[model samples]
Target: MTVFILVGGVFTGADVWRETAARLAAAGREAHAVPLTAIDAGRPAVGHVDLETHIADVTAAIDAVGEGPGREIVLVGHDYGIHPALGAADRRPQRVDRVVYLDCGMPRDGVPPLAAVPDPALRARLAARAGRGETQGELAPPATHEEWQRWGSTAGVGVAALDRLTALAAPQPLGTLLQPLRLSEAVAAVPATGVLCTRNGVGIDLVQRLVDFGDPVAAALAGPRVTFFELPTGHWPMLSCPAELADVLLRAAAGAGHRLRPADTGTPPAHLRPFPLDVPEVPRDRKGHVDLYVPGEGGARPAVVFVHGGPVPAAARPTPRDWPTLVGYARLAAAEGVVGATLDHRLHDVADYERAAADVTAAVELVRADPRVDADRIALWFFSGGGLLAAPWLAEPPAWLRCLAASYPVLEPPPGWGLGDSRFRPVRAVAHAGALPVVLLRAGREAPGIAATVEAFVAAAKDSGARLELVDVPHGHHGFETLDPAEETGPPLRHAMRAVVTRLTG
Candidate 1:
């Protein structure tokens, strides 16, 4: 059988599935990782490559790989790649023998990919980002390590393998996320399997939850023709647990008639459970709420407060407490035996940088007052816009503040955004950073202006005797935390988060 592997969304190329392909090839199966037109080496795709374009790309790959008369094509799709995989199967059911949906959305006719996202807020956020003119409808990756890991589990992969995948990820075109898959009912006839990396069945439960909430794709996975197989890993099993994923794929391809196994029904780890939401820090204020996630066996644990990116237009701002990525990271931190707190601060238009700083300060006080939290050990994590607001704290941080982490932070105003305002220049704080340790995580592929500002800050911090460490994500872009976190970027994100947690807890 000729196995055609299609990778997930974003700037990802076929290289994301290299391990799975090589393993299948070693097992004596014909395997090919098909690169989509948007990411193909020599194709050089231009503006707005839609679903049809992707379908054509996959169709051509299928035709090229299934050239032999006797060869049977097994189509495999990961994440957003499922749309094209199914589209190809619908277009050439006679040529395709099996279809595998690997921890991805299983799209049907008419519904676009973004419309199928279970969360309405997330769908809107994606659309809003696309509508922003200068961005040209391109979405960057998740901006932080915690957000990246929360997007997918990468516990099973080695550092080298994860890094290789991260290096290959690119900025995804918005059209691909918005395009509807043109699939036909005939696709049902092709043998299909839904390979879920549930990490001890949480994925299964989440799917069932979405189905209960009326998600059509989740509802379709519950269909009779689709066999569900669970793998105890994160979303990107091809990178996290490739050997086992390959085994399952090979078994399905060989027509072994495998069935869904009994999933682990034990209590999920603390981090995976639903954390307490909308706990008020400032009881009288409507927007002064915070979400807290605590580890199962916690006892006066250290805490890390997450400050989200923004200062965005009021009309487009989201309630930070409800953000899935932030909430997930809080839960993940709790799972790691740290108290994770995600807070909401005033927007730039509503309050100056000082007011935002005060909001974070109030949040820290609230956390410190909690009986379950270690009052003496606390850390602050800032992303993008939040980085500027954190300047005062970084300059003259409280004795109790253990560490500070900033990811792709806007330490200085963009050239056109009132650079004359010293209030917004976080670089000035470097001289006052003192002996307090700071972790600065930057994307190597960010805008030149942002890179230059960060470079200046790093140089200044070093000369000022501030104990600072810089972690570089070579292939990532600005706001990576909000983008699709692929296997390649997971390790660095995890590493950065762990370092912060260690410093604060120690």
Candidate 2:
């Protein structure tokens, strides 16, 4: 039998993996814990890691084990470590009997792993501060309670040391973080299991049981050839509930031997092979993939594009909380006989929004290239953070746009708009204008200082003879609470969006 390799995740060290290895060793089973350089958030001395590097490290461990003894291996990935495990397993599927994901899952095709978390702005902010690298792709953790506190209390490490570590940390490749894991078809066929730590849901303030189960680790419960078990502990079960965690893993391992193959219940209609007909079909990047869901229309239709903001390569990474808003917005635009495209633009803290504006302009060119699209009739609709990326255009409207409808647009990047330094430095950055018709929406309860920025943009557009429709919105930071109707939220922002869309397009 080969050994089971445990891959350590964010802020987690060999010690975390060691705990599991110790348990496995005590059980008289072969196991090897592999730690690939992401622990020590305070000391990001190690170079940056995309899944590829992490994958290489784990694959080397398996090869080392295989060379030493001919033991069948079962791989384990905890937290961010799952990236490397999946990458490695994709290479050696048969040699490994199973791959166990312990609370760590990567985006499957288009979205980046870190980008999938709903409202992950907080985490992304921390990753940059913690020196995890620019892409926020690396994870080695204080995944457990003690670990989190330890990081907070580690004041002894000199600030100089911290700075040095941060300098050593590297940036994530543009697309890998959002590029979705590319796996051999064989890897998906492998029997895998997920062990979820419920501590996450508890801390999150409002995660339901089903939502927790839908997590990557929990996705196994619904995905084929995979099983899921949730534990009410922090993200790291090894430290929070090692004994129970071990037991769950052992049982899941036992269950893996019994493959479930039954008669088919039913077959899907041809139109629904993978998804619904309204799904927006967009073009792909180098990987030949696009995250936007554009409806398939046999004839030409007016086209509209969606450009998301993150200043990160995988800007289009899906947000769990925004599913309703995105789908609804897409549906609304599609119903208007228009093609919708949500673009994944390049991002960085030191990003030049003007460059992003140019990127959006190129995307518009692409949309215009297709005969299926009425290039001259395109409408630009965006709100909240996405509005920031397009704000630069208000002064210098993109040449191809039919018109621009923006809500709560932040004309300039606020002092701390997630980027360490301000990229939208007033004058030089935002110079888009010239008799363009535009609609501006602002949250009534927006941050005091932010309102000025919004006003400035509106003023600039007006100064340039652009038609500005100012609508006072009674809402919060992101306007997602409005898109998904069935969802219950405090106020109604959807009404605000509808009003803006109607004024801009109608």
What TM-score do all the candidates reach, one by one?
0.48, 0.41
As a whole number from 0 to 100, the lDDT of residue 94 in candidate 2 is 66
lDDT of 1 by residue, 1-506 (tens): 45655545545678777788888998988887877876756566866677777888888887777356657788888767888788888998988888988876557688777654433345668767656732335566554433344344555667776666666666666777776677778888898887776541234533443443333444565555667677877667887877888888888776643343222335332113332332222211122466667665547989888887655333322456555556666766775678888888765431345667677778888888888789999988888767777677877878988998988887765422322334556788878878788998899876554566788889889788888888888877665544424554566667777888889867
Which 10 successive residues of model 1 have the least lDDT summed? 278-287
Residue-level lDDT of model 2, residues 343-459, one tens digit each, is 544443223455666666676677776676666666676654456666455545655565666655445543222232333432223344555556555666554444556777666
| Model 1 local distance difference test score | 0.68
Local distance difference test, each candidate: 0.68, 0.51
True lDDT of residue 125, candidate 2: 60
